[model samples]
Target: MIAIGFEGSANKIGVGIIKHTPDGKVEVLANVRHTYITPPGQGFLPRDTAVHHRAHVIPLTKQALEKASLKPSDVDCICFTKGPGMGAPLVSVAIAARTLSLLWGKPLVAVNHCIGHIEMGRMITGAKNPVVLYVSGGNTQVIAYAEHRYRIFGETIDIAVGNCLDRFARILNLPNDPSPGYNIEQGAKRGKKFFELPYAVKGMDVSFSGILSYIETLSTTHLKTGKCTAEDLCFSLQETVFAMLVEITERAMAHIGSSEVLIVGGVGCNERLQDMMGKMVAQRGGYLFATDERFCIDNGLMIAQAGILMFKTGHVTPLEDTWCTQRYRTDEVLVTWR
Candidate 1:
C-alpha cells in the first residue's frame, strides 16, 4: 500500500511518500522538509509556524509526489500527524490532510507524533521492542512497549530537554537557521570548561525548568563577568541535561529489564546525547539504536510509517473525527498494529 504523510508540528513542515511492498518491506519514496527559521534570540510562535506550514505544505506535497514519481491517484491513503504539538501547526497540517483525503478519495489516518518517532526508529535500526527515549523540543519521555500501548516510564515535569537547549541558545543569541539545538551542539564541541549547572532528576522522571532558569541567570552574570564563555555554558548545559536524560533512561531500562534502547525525536539526533546514551547502554551490555537528521528529527516519513501500520490494521479516522489536538499522549493510542 502507498501512503503520503504531512507533518507540521513545530517550526518545520514536511511531506513524505512511502509504500509497503507486498513482501513486507517499507520503501521511502520521498521525504522533504522546510523549516521556519527565526532570528537569533527568538523562538517560533504557533501563529507564525502555522503560517509557514500553510504557505509551504502545498509546494512540499508537490515536491514529495514528484520525488516519489507518483500521482495523488496512486496513493492508497493520506496520513498526518494528529497532535502532541502546537495547536495551530497541528490544525494546519490536519486541514491539508483532510483536504487531500476528500479530493483524492483516500482514507485519513491520524498518527500520534511520538509513535511516529518510535516506529521510524524501530524500522531504521531494526530494534524490536527496545526501550525508547523520546527527546524533542516539545517532549521528553522514556517509554517501553507493553501490553497494547507504549508505556511511559519517565518524562519531564516541566519544560522538555530540547526546549531547555533552545531557550539557552536564545539567551546566547545563537542563530536558529538550522536549529537552536544544533548550533548549541556545535558550540559545545568547542567548549573547554565544564561550568556547573543544576541537575534535577526526580527518580524515573526529570525536570529542566530549574536548570533553564539557573542557566538563564548564569548567562546574565557569567557571560559579562567572564566567569564562563558561551561555549563553556553550552558544554555545561549539554553535559548536565544529557546526563539527566541518560540517568533516567538507564533507570527505566533497568526497571523494565530491557537490554536494548532506542532514542527518537529531534533532540535524539544530538551527537553528544547519542554518545552519552551509547556509553551507558554499552556498559549494560546492550545496543543503542539511533538515526540521523533525516529520520531523527520531526519528518513526514515517520508519520507515514506509523500511520500506514495503523491503516493496515483497519484503523482510519473518519472525516468528522479528523480534528487535531495538542495533548495526545504516547500511551493514549492502542497499539493494535503491534
Candidate 2:
C-alpha cells in the first residue's frame, strides 16, 4: 500500500509519502518539512499560523507528491491529523486532505495527533505491548496497551511537558524560534553543575507549573541582584524536569509490570530526557526506545504508516467522518486496524 500524509498540528508543516511492501516493511519515499516561527513560548497563533499554512500547505503537498514521483491516483489513501490540534490549523490540513481524497477517489484516515507519537515509536522499534510515554507540546502521558488499544495510565494534571520547557526557554531569554525542547537542550549543554531549582514529583503524576514559576522567580531575582549564572539555571531546570519524568515513568513501569518502555512525542527528542529514561529503564532491566525528529515531532510518515495499517484493516473514515475537533481522547479509540 502506498499513501500520502499531511501534518499541520503545530508550527512545522509536514507532508510525506510512504510505501508499504508485500513483506510488511515500510519505506518513506518523500518527507518534507516547512516551519513557521511564533512569538516566544508560543508554537502558534490561530490567526497567523492558519494564514501561514494556507499559503504553503497546497504547494508542500504537491512537492511531496512530486518528490515521491507519485500522483494522487497512485496513492492508495490520504491520511491526516484530524483532531487534538489548533482548530484553525486542523481545519486547514483537514480541508486539504479531504479535497485530495475526494478528487483522487482514495480512502481517508483521520488520526489523533498524540497517538501518532506512540504509533511512531511502535513502528520504529517494532515493539508491541510496550509501555508508552508520550511527551510533547500539548501532552505528557504514561500509556499502556490493552485489548488492541493503547490507553493513558497517567498524564499531566496541568500544563504539558513541552509547554513547560518552552515557557522556561522564554523566561531564560533563549531562542524559541526552533523547537522549545531543542533550545532548552542547547542551553543545558553549555552548563556545568546543576542549579538548585524546585523539583516536584507527586506519586504517578508530576507538576512543572510550580517549577516553571520558581524558575521565573529566580530569573527575576538574579537579574536584580546579579548573583546567579544562566548556564547553571538551565542545567538545574532540565535536571529537575527530566528527573520528575524519569521517576514517574519508572514507577509506572513497575505498577503496570511492563519491562519495555518507549518514549514518544516531540519532547522525547531531548538528549537529557533520553539519557535519563535510558538509564532508568536499563537499570530495571527494561528497554527504552525513542524516535528521531523524523517521527518524533509531528510529521506525515507516522500518519501514512498508521493509515496504511488501519485502512488495510477496514478502519477507514467515510466522507461523513470528516469533521474536526479540539479534543480527542486516546483511550476511547479502539484500534480497528490490526
* Top TM-score model: 1
For residue 231, model 1's alpha carbon misses the true position, in angstroms, by 0.3
Best by lDDT: 1
lDDT of 2 by residue, 202-274 (tens): 7778788888898888878875786767776788888888888888888878987989888888898887899
Report residue 172 deviation for candidate 2 (angstroms): 2.4
User: What lDDT does the true structure give each of the candidates?
Assistant: 0.94, 0.82
Give the local distance difference test score of model 1.
Answer: 0.94
Per-prediction TM-score, please? 0.99, 0.95
Q: What is the lDDT of residue 226 in candidate 1?
A: 92
